[model samples]
Target: MTQEPKGILIVDDDQDMRELLERRLRRWDLDVVSAENGVDALEVLEREGIQLMITDWMMPEMDGLELCRAIRSRAFSRYIYIILLTGKAERHELVEGIEAGADDFIVKPFKKEELHVRIRAGMRMIQFERQKETAIQALRKKNLELEQAGATIRAHLEAAGKLQQAMLPLDVEHLGGVHFESLFVPCEYVAGDMFNYFELSDTKIAFFLLDVAGHGVPAAMQSVTISKVMNPLTLRARKAPTESSGEVKTRLLNFQDPAELAASLNRMFMGPKTGTQYFTMIYGVIDTEKNRVQFVQAGHPSLILLKSDGELKAIGEGGYPIGLLPKATYFAIELDVAPGDRIFIHSDGITDCRDANRKSFGFERLHEILSAKRQCSMRETLETIHRELISWTESATLEDDLSIVAMEFK
Candidate 1:
């Protein structure tokens, strides 16, 4: 269907001129309206919604210049292009007309073709203004939709962050006569790092810390999945029954070895079904009665051990990261711990943290901090590390997820 042409208004005190212009414009397939003076012209314009106007320079009540000024001062739903009909030929007169808001002008005794060209020019300006308004409206609508989508995504991320935080170890500081302390920070609302320490038996305590390959939702989801599967019930050794005095009794064996646990996780996550995601982890078990610490490092940072006498040691030879290869092998290393010795397991986010100068807070600095804080309590030491890390990076947030789990023998 064709759109209707916008109406044009002709204003003049001369009836003959108004009638003649209307007839000519109608003959050219244009919608036209006419009035004898500026007052009547404004009434016709308001009633007809005309967007183009041609007015005589002089009239009894309101002249063309006065009408132009009035129209420009008032706000309308759309733009109106005005052309003045004037006999004045002086440059100053033309400038005055333009300053009064006339868009174009045609002298008296004008050729019909010149009049037609002026009308066409006015129509083109109106059309361009309409197009610009339409585009601006469309852009505003798109911006509103994007803002709504962003709000929804932010809400979901905040909820997920709370859930991830709930999965962390709580009040496990004195579990099985061993003291535990930790720190966790994420660059975004959700994190890819997880840690927990739980009692597997009366005398055995298990702890683990793992960092997924990246940050944000995908990595956070995978880290949550790993945390659930690494719980004591899933990773604990199977129970067996024995006959004692003809009575059947069941006893708990040792928890799953750290190496076997890593292997199992690798097998579960490696393959085409699991995508290309992988993670570094340190999983350990401490026997309180024997003062023995056994752990596996799956391509994770080495564990830091601070002895009671203030001697420091870095343990573990890095192994393959879990889920990277189908046949990757992991082995557990065992060490004897003395009373008051502290073991630290952390993600690489700490040592790899950088400052404005692009210098990494490497392992050497971490060792120095641990050695300097040896006299402090386990909780104080972990808090000191957290403060130092933030100070080193000189940022409220880090570039990656940061996590650390520290345990001290009783």
Candidate 2:
């Protein structure tokens, strides 16, 4: 990645002087390009890759200062090193030459070694200029490559995200006298945030949201596994028992039931704690026949119940986070769903969020959002919360994952 030596343009009207200077410089490995006057020197600059320029200040048509000014007017001229040869040795004359882009100068009747020193200094300047230009170009190339890679990866993730969304039961009719809704939003890092809902059986309808601990392709793959395991089981279960969501609520108002699904999840993923990895999830069976909602909470946030009359309740006894300890039990919580009530189930990313000041939005803030917007539709309430969440992080870049799901019972 090296270029030929910086072409030294020797501008002198005397042919003998030009040959002598050229011969002296050619003794070194430096490239030398000759011109008789400033006019010819400017042409050499346009036509040749001149890195170190040496011009006589007394040249006709364009003096050394004028040539320097013209060179300075161009972009990237800083990369070129210039040396002015002056007959006047006065201090002011030397200063004038320096101001006119002379990186170094030599007086008339100067020794060969003196000229050598001036050229050597100019060579060092050229070397520095070459290095800086090389570094800048390298950096620009890396940045462009990174941008392209990001675009490609984002497109693929977005496609996978759309597929994940389509896999959800988007229009499940309100069963068991319960209204259902679900939401998922990926932070820049796509993680194992997957959700599923379906009729588990004729008497019981099932719904669950699962969030894996990490992000990117690994989390996305885990999400696929969760979907494959749950969706089919849910579809088959619908053939068996029968119950309206209203019946499920009635039992929860009374007592608890060990959802068989909890044992299934705990068995499949929650193993020995040696890097025992799993996810947090909340699965609820809406038993329309019993009028109760039986659910399992595995290290997740408490479900928020927003009543139509403007009251908000945090449902579920928060349980141990999944995959933390080996064989940790993820138990189910029971809640009664009265008429005209709404329940919100979400990831901790919502309330545990922080701002620039590192302050948590917290459980209390979430409750307030729900209480204030109790009368709004589930969609509107979710939007309001999202808007506030964004505003909260305005002073800082987005730091974590966020999601909110609202379920209303009419």
TM-score of 2: 0.83
Listing every candidate in turn, what is its Cα RMSD in Å to the true structure after a full C-alpha superposition?
A: 6.0, 6.7
Per-residue accuracy of model 2 over 279-390 as CA lDDT, tens digit each: 7878787777766778888777877777667778787776765555544665667777677888788887778778878898889988998888877777777778778888
Q: TM-scores, in order shown?
A: 0.83, 0.83
User: Model 2 segments beyond 4 Å from truth?
Assistant: 1-6, 26-32, 76-78, 171-173, 215-217, 233-259, 271-276, 307-311, 395-398
* lDDT against true structure, model 2: 0.71
lDDT of 1 by residue, 1-410 (tens): 22334588889999999898988899888988888888898887777778899999999899999999988988888788999998987999999999999999999989899988888888778888888888888899999999999999999999999989988987347888888988888889999999999987898889999999989999999999888777666654444343469785755433448887787777667746568479999999898889999999999999989999999999998999988987799899999998899999999998999989999999999999899989887778777877888899888888989889988888
Q: Candidate 2: minimum summed lDDT over ten consecutive residues — where?
A: 248-257
